[model samples]
Target: MPKGEKVKAILFDANGMDREIAPLADVAHIPDKQIYWLIVSGQGAGKLPHPADGIDRAALRRGGVVVSDDRFCFSVPVAPNEGGHSEDAMILVVGRNWLVTCSDAPLSLTERYLEHDTGETLKGSLTAPALAVSLLLAHFDEFHTHLSAIEEKLDALDEQVFRSRQRHDPLNTLAVLRRRAARLRGLVAQHRSTIAALDRPDFGPAVCEEDRHHLTHLAGAYHRLVDTIDRTRDAVLSSYDLYATRVAQNTNRLLQRLTVITVGIGLIGALAGIFGMNFELALFKGEAPAFLMVVAGMAAIATVTLFMATRRS
Candidate 1:
């Protein structure tokens, strides 16, 4: 094991024996082909299981899968942290009777899996390949929790858009939601590729029937999640379109009102210009009544223009 690496070894056999043991220098001591799990974390990749030298140390540093004749190694992505960044540190190495896993960081799901009752008994019946799939199934459970959170956020956004009367802008909220959905989609795609590779017949030893069924069902669940996100993205885009339409209508209405007021002012200007011209007219001899009459006429013109504009609206 690597210096300062947190490594744990557990042996489980068909005889119901379950116990932790120190790193055995030889694998031939176990005659029943018993299952062994060597779980490591935080720089544990420095000491890989024997016969796994073909597994590239560099590729194992990231989240991906690589298979050779004797061993296959892969990585699983954990859920994003509070900072909204996913750290890919979980790596798995499968051999004939032993499975080794490493993560650059401590994973919550890993802790939970270790504490679960099924974890102790899984080796009794499951092969190395099936055990790996089971771990992925557990990871999918975590992924679904994240999807549920996104659904709640989408529901709130839908409510705010449709039910609220306040002039609250949802642009920022929509942008955030879209980003979250996109990130999830990318992660799901990566997982899908990894799962597909594992499902291939030539990937490694055949998994048990139960595990194969579970994997198929899990793939279906992932597809459903992707479809749900697609619908959510569409719904958010529709809300944006609705908001823009409402804004355009409001602006056009305001312009219509301003146009009416402008025409009314022009009417008054035209009348004043005609009277101010140097022309001999009997109607306006610089009398107070003539001025009052002009004022009344201007007021009447403004009122008529406003009434006509409102009626049309």
Candidate 2:
């Protein structure tokens, strides 16, 4: 395979045993009785032969789906980046006996599904629609994993917001998380109509009874996934509110301290200003005694002011 192109083919025989085949094997040449899955990574989608007729290449590139009598084609978002941006989508084209998946990069979920049976047991031969649903469900699992990781981060952020004495605002961090949650929610929602369409009786693929059940189950799973994302978003918003409250409390405490200091200084300055006046009064005749009296009086005033300022309201 070329540097930007990689392919993996898995052929499932009549006995339900899956084995690897040549990466470049032609789908048209494969036997109709056997079901095969082709995964193309990087720029492999462009290099490989098109999987089915009536597939809109433009729509596939733009993260859209096309369903027809002979094929079902759609694009789903891949795992998101740390910054919450979904930079690419994986395209899936399903035919009667074959299924082809293409993405900008190799997916670990796909590899794991290929390497080990992740509870999706193959009782009989795997049908193309069943394989497609399985892969779709696997992608939904990725969404849950990603959200769980986000939830952990939110937990850590909660600790930082409430317990840590660090004087940094968590708004930026919270904003990033909010954006990530929104992006995830948007990506999951994009498939809502498409997934619902799969359950419709008029859907193109000749879905088997078992596959239809799986498809219905997949729809339900998608709904749950959306609900999870919504809750995650709510958590982020709640964190934002908590952070704002913390900031307001800190600001109030700082202002109170500053007000106390200002009041104390003003009282002492007023006393000093009066003593420095040019008017020579009888009290100034006793130089040492008068200076001592002024000092004591200022001290007394400062003590009173300090006492009043320190008292909690």
Candidate 3:
């Protein structure tokens, strides 16, 4: 295991020549020039059952903090203080020697850096800490990508609701999308603080002008992403409301037609029921069949009258 270096100033990245490197299990040491953002696991992490031989055969829960120097590697998953960390992974500064990073959560930003062409960029760096900061800055582009995607989806949904001649339930789609947005929103908000802490004058404290600029840019990106999420949420709600109104209007029109038909049918039935009575009458005595026929004619006449009334209504 490596020993950690004393915490000092923040390292900056002026040029975008950030590189990616493979993570190690634990840090051997940290250099004085780098930042040590640590990702340790919680004590009670992992869901695996314990073995009789006392083997901790479970994944460790993640607990994140900034470390000045440590022996742990960035990829080294540690035992967390509490639950299994499937949400976020961790990163650490290996005692003035290397920058280690690990995470319980799936981070696309990490993937982005790893995909860069320069497999040797991280390895070729003059200072390991500075290299780590560069990789971290490069990773921010991924967050921005996700944020933009969410916004685009919301905008598309808004167009469908407003312009589509066909109507559908906007609530279902909107609700789900809103929830996802909220989740990302929370994640970004939390990340902003962490990154800000890295850039703070007193905290990790940037070393040069370049690192300071990179940190500032990262903060700005966070603000922009957050604003986009908020606007998307508003658009989702607006689309839902508009869809609701259209649905209500369609329902009311259908009911109005049904009501008219019902009234018409009721009038004709009433006329027939009244005439159907078997009460004795001088005119109906001998010509009972003829009297019934006349009653039928009157019912027909009533039906026509009811039809016209309903039509005009």
In model 1, where do residues sit more than 4 Å from their true spots?
Answer: 9-38, 49-57, 61-72, 82-84, 94-99, 112-131, 147-151, 154-169, 201-203, 270-313
lDDT-wise, the better of 1 and 2 is: 2
Q: What ordering of candidates by TM-score runs from best to worst?
A: 2, 1, 3
What lDDT does candidate 1 reach at residue 293?
94
- 38-85, model 3: which lDDT tens digit per residue? 322232232211111121223222223333322222222222111212
lDDT of 1 by residue, 183-231 (tens): 7667666676767766665555544466556657666766776786677
- Candidate 2 residue-wise lDDT, 1-313, digit = tens: 5477777777777654667777534566766557777787885434444454345444676644576666777777776766667777788888777888877788887888777762334522666887888888888988898899888988888888788564566787788888889988888878877787787776665666777787788888889999999999999999888888888887887788778878888989988998788899899999999999999988888787777767732
Q: How close is candidate 2 to the true structure, as a TM-score?
A: 0.77
Instruction: Give me the candidate number with maximum TM-score.
Output: 2
* lDDT for position 28 in model 3: 41
Q: Flag the better candidate by lDDT, 2 or 3.
A: 2
The true-versus-predicted C-alpha distance at residue 273 of model 1, in Å, is 4.4
TM-scores of the models, in the given order? 0.70, 0.77, 0.52
lDDT of each: 0.69, 0.76, 0.49
What range of 10 consecutive residues in model 2 has the weakest lDDT sum? 117-126
Question: Which regions of candidate 3 are displaced past 4 Å?
Answer: 1-86, 92-99, 103-108, 119-134, 137-172, 204-206, 266-313
